[model samples]
Target: MTTPTSCAYCQQRATQLCAGCRSVVYCSREHQKEHWKRGHKRECKCYEVTSNELLGRHLRATRDIRMGEQIMCEAPLVVGPKVAATPLCLGCHRNLLAPQKPAMTFYKCSSCSWPMCSKECEKSPFHLDECRLMAASNFQSKINYNPADPEGKESAYCVIMLLRCMQLKRSNPEAFARLAALEDHLKERIETPLYQVLRANLITFIKTVLGQRDWPELEILRIAAILDTNAFEVRQNGERRKVRAIFPGGAMIAHDCVPNLRHRFDDNMRIIFLAKRPIPKGAILSISYTQPLRSTVQRRVHLKQVKCFDCACERCSDPTELGTFAGAHLCGKCKVGKVISQNPLENAANWHCQLCNVKKSAREVLTQDARLQQEIESLDKTTPVHLEEFIQGHRIDLHDTNTHILQAKYALTQLYGTAPGYAMDELSEESLKRKVDLCEELLQISNLFDGGWSIFRGNLLIDLEEALVAQALRLQLASECESKLKRAEELLEEIKNIMKHEPEEMQQMLAERQQILNAAMAPFSVGVE
Candidate 1:
């Protein structure tokens, strides 16, 4: 009707739409076949799923992609409450806050007898599929909707996602096929404690209570395994609502400590993957499955425990952790040398001081690291007093770039401006300078590990931008004020770009930031009354 846009292969007039996906238009049969042969055959969308023994199923770029390019935008196949989640609306997925009056109880769905926010939410599309299935089971939810402890997690919430997945077999077989095709790692997960619980509870509920005996025990467990491995944690509704969703295409992307891809969920809850840097064709696409601020050992352990895979990514293999030495500690013997692992990929490898050659057993290093972590965790973080003390006490033992130190610094960056009694205007001259210095140092580390439109970098930029603006407002000299203002302006522009794909709520916050920064920078004013 609209002339079919341009050909995907040649940028020429085209009418033939790709029959497989109907996403791309072809100029001619010859070009279509040629393009398919070139790589399009594998890519129904932007990246192609490929398999390897090391990484299992992984995605690769079908064509060269520019930085910040949106590579994939996929609607979730299924969405529901997390495996262990606080009480939330079954329909809207919003947190169910405790009622103001002690006697009042949460509204339950008329059909399913499950908690919902409102009558409108009871009719929500997300609730309908499960409402019908759950209603038919003649089983009423006994969630013990206690108004006193509304935020407490319900074990029953876990059954909803599994039921939704099981329903897809009849409701949407095509989507069910995609879900089935996903790597479940069931063999590896079957012996786990969680699976045993599922075997006793979830399997029995589906077969005996719900009267779904056709679904095999192994098949039911496989679905749970697939969800555990592939589901992405989704936070929405201004982050008050927490849920998990399965994006089949998104799960195909591999994991790396220093990943090339950054993903965000849109208002529609569709997962969008963007290239954080320019990616050459044939390169594998990756995103970090763990926190960027965690040390290599911490990340690797988390990956192995939850994901059931040993990560041998470039950043993990290098003991220096891309030269940040995030996991390294100060040598007790040398005092000057940084203690580093001999082989980062192996868990049992001995750590040695570079300068002193003092060897420490893996267990010894791990025990020391864990103790330090507990020390940091135990600190009273409401004020900067304990964090500052921790940093000063560990200066000789833990460098600024050490993972624990970085974690504290990042927290400080958030606390300085917003924390009660430590607001920007209330900050002393020394504390203001400290905030600026902390931000500048962290920005450098962020560039190395999570650079190029990453959420980590964007958040750091936001902090730095605000700090710079505050500094500019306080400075006496016009030139210094102007320089700080200029840098703040540049940072705000980048933040806008990085957060372009974020939800409406985030955009609203950015808008507020823009207004505040603009007011501060108005008329190039520097002198105070």
Candidate 2:
């Protein structure tokens, strides 16, 4: 017999509640709906559910979150041990630590006296703009100084946000001012959320709880929030959606081996999430927030050490989970067999099939993949000009849709139109058509993987339309060239629609393509039958 709790909004006995924020509760579905409508929307986390010590804790919804909706927009809480940072506290951005040894020395914050690990870190380009402001502030607490520590290690989430803000400040002052004024506490901490949180909590804890104004624990938490927020999400260009590394707030979403959501970033650095599959109500929505290519043991180890969670997600619990997706290969002996896991976590495996018996270790497959990747990386930048052989070599080891292979194909597509090498002007008509076919094939895959209004798809369409026009012109048939030109116009219209938001860049490309199209049509437009 458990006691019923009251809702934070309407004061009714609540059974269903949020698990993250724990600031609100709900009596029933109807009450929850009514309360949500009345203005509990922004701070409501009713959908999130997690257990603390096995007891369900309900958190309030922070905003009226739709399915696959973004609930909060946060800034990074800290900056960096920048490859180029002047002696600023990566935690507070104060000129605290100083360089201990100039040659053996990494730059340390003059104020905090904390030294970074490397000179490159001391010279991070991202840290340059902020160094001046940090230096000018006299490294003292002003009315604008809100010094609050974050919940854990410096939040990479906050640090990255601050860096973006600082960059914005340099490029667009009005926008920067607007962001700075968004929260009063932020302004005091030089518009840093990590500092505001730390200041508020540290002040209260010291005055009310411990009767002290400062604590080392507070500083540690501030640093943690900074690290959590500032970490970068590095990814390749054509990945349908930008994939960012999980930051602090994002990292808190928890893990499920069978995740419900997938996320990608835009060029502008906004995080977007999609429903990988339909999720029912009361379901705990989750995203992997990590590299899906890693093994269970590797993933769990990284998550535990870096994120402080023991992931018992379904993928982690099963030995063969994710099907050892990252490390699978064909069997050489059987020729028709696939390698599989005997124990995925332990990296022990055997390759066999229903018809034959064969075996291989995880190490052998991983080493092979690594070797292939290294070789692929070693190719000269101009290799795309010789796309046929490049693609053929990749096919030997990498799957058609593997990220690296897809990237290579994208480069090949661009080269078909732009490459000025021997392969370009010397291309045979049949060879040119083959290149067009390859572009079409790759575009179809791009649509499947990253089709949500992507510029890559638009560019591919533009290139294909141009190739078709060229093919028609070469035939020296007026009527046929005109028809192909019409098709090119249609393709351009489609590109315009997708690129409406990027009018300048799209217009420039459109203008260039139109000139080429006009030249192709000039011979057809003259007086003729």
Q: Count residue pairs with overlapping backbones in model 2.
A: 85
lDDT of 2 by residue, 110-217 (tens): 432234434444455545455444455443211111224211133222333334444565576765454443212212233366456655664453334433234344
Please write out the lDDT profile of model 1 over residues 1-529, one tens digit for every residue. Answer: 2335788889898989876445689989998998899888666665677898998888887667788888888899999999878778888788776344333467898987888888999999888988887788888887655656656778888999998899999989999999999988888889999999999988999899888999999999999999999999987767467799999988989999889999988777889899898888789999999989888998998998888889999989999999999999887887888999999999889999999969999999899889999999999889888899999999988988999999899889988988889999999888988998998999899888898889999998888888888889888998898888988889899999988888887789889989988887776754745
Q: Best TM-score goes to which candidate?
A: 1
Model 1: colliding residue pairs: none
Error of 2 at 239 (Å): 22
The C-alpha local distance difference test score for the whole of candidate 2 amounts to 0.50
Alpha-carbon local distance difference test for all models: 0.87, 0.50
Q: After superposition, how far is residue 188 of candidate 1 from its true place, in Å?
A: 2.1
In model 1, the worst 10-residue window by lDDT is 97-106
Q: Clashes per prediction?
A: 0, 85
Off by over 4 Å in 1: 1-44, 98-103, 525-529
